[model samples]
Target: MGIITDIVLPVSLAFIMISIGLTLTLGDFRRVAAQPRDFLIGAVSQIIVLPLVAFALVTAWRVEPVLAVGVMIIAAAPGGVTSNLLTLFARGDVALSVSLTAITSLLSVVTVPLIVVTAHQHFVAGSGGEVAGDLTVTGAVLKIFVIVTVPVLAGLAVRHTMPGFALRFEPLARRISAVLFVLVMVGAIYAERANIGSYFAQAGAITLTLNIAMMAIAFYGAAWLGMRRPQRIAIALECGLQNGTLAIAVAASLFHETLYAIPAAIYSLMMFGTALAFVFLVTRGRPAAV
Candidate 1:
């Protein structure tokens, strides 16, 4: 796992982001105009409600200070690519899913840092003890820009300037990204193995509760906002699952603490199962509505 992280994982994540960016055009945002309500609900739910819910859970659970920061980091990071796959599985709006990914990921460079600072100021100030000089907002942004945004922009540029090249390489890029993401998960798990038992033993109920609540908010909140079934599914999955790899990266690179990184590692493993159950429970017998 450590070997993978030091090599394949970083490269793959960059490629994955680039692949997603390659599929984009200005028209993606234009499409949002056609379904403003769905997009608005999804953005609000993801950027606002999801983090708030996470913060509340972290507080209620009395998570270890470092672990609470991890939760907030996950909340701050962009929605995962997994959301799009889950959206497809649940037969939701694919265009909306793609648009949401593109928009949120692009916005993450700014939003994530702000979220991180705010979470720290609010949640960590009283907790006492600064992490280290390495864990600054600028450091977090630089890491994210390198690992996520740059590859995406590079892929997007390639797709735009050399369409034939992009067409040929797109699939390979996505495969690389997937392999990298998996490697990041493995690295995180291995790195945090010693702390896993303690984290779950103390934070397990809180983690599960937070996951369930986030999932519920996606569907129920979207429904309350009068979103259609498809949009609800997309928003729900996005809310429930987070970019755990990014969280771990930020925690490790920016914060310099494994304790702060472990939640994301555990979350990466836990969310897949939790999200699958959610899909089955929410979509069963309904058929693919969208």
Candidate 2:
């Protein structure tokens, strides 16, 4: 379990990031400049509002401190590649979804550390004295950079240098990433199998509420902001789906405790069901695409 949490999880997360990178290009980032207002709308909704909402839930619910930190970690995560695919399914703006996911992912190297450390300070440290092996901002930034930014950058370089190869291999890499995600969840759960039922019981309601709340927030916010239907759908799913793998990695690797990862793991499972229903609800009785 130690080896799996410390080593295997990090390596697998890096590869998952690399797979996400395979689908990106410089243009994705440039989409920010190309459409700054819309991008800002989505960015604020995600990077700013999501964590704020999580904190509210944590504070309102008075969740267990470590688990509250876990909730924050998952909330802090960027959108995952699955959101891009779901955007396609919802007939939303795939290009916009890809752009949002790519930028948030790159931004996470900083954002994740900040959120985690803040949550740790507020939840764990505030609740009790400082625990041993507390995660510092600097240490978390470095760890996330090594496992996240560098891998995504490497994948981008591969795509640029070998477009044909990247095209041929990206699907395979994404499939492998999916398998790895499942394995990581299983490993995390198995490691804490004894407490699994309690963790889920404690975590299920909050995580599910977070997922549904954020989906509603992003969707209605987009609509209220006068975004088109497809853009609204894309923003909604992107905010809802979160990078749980990265959240788990932080809990398991940075904090050295899979107990903190329980919410993220459970959140990861709950999201797919909600996302599928979201897609169905939005896309039903609709045209194939815009």
Best by TM-score: 2
Give per-model TM-scores. Answer: 0.90, 0.97
Model 1, range 1-290, lDDT digits (tens) per residue?
Answer: 45555665566666668888877666777999987888888888888887888888888878777678778888777777778878888888767887887788877887787787667766666578674564556766777778778877886788789888888886676566666777787777677787678877766666677778888878887788777888788888887778776776667666656677677767777788999998788778785543
For model 1, what is the alpha-carbon lDDT of residue 92? 80
Best-fitting candidate, measured by lDDT?
Answer: 2
Clashes of each: 2, 0
**Clashing residue pairs in candidate 1 (N, C-alpha, C atoms within 3 angstroms):** 18-152, 135-254
lDDT of each: 0.76, 0.88
* Candidate 2, superposed: residue stretches over 4 Å from native: none
Model 2: lowest-lDDT 10 consecutive positions: 126-135
- What is the per-residue lDDT of model 2 for residues 1-290, given as tens digits with 9 covering 90 to 100? 67778677887899989888888888887877898878888888889999999999989988888899999999999998889889999999889998888888999999999998988998999888456395689999998898889989888899899989999999899788888888888888889899989999888899999999999999998899889988899899989999888888878767766778999999999999999999999988987845
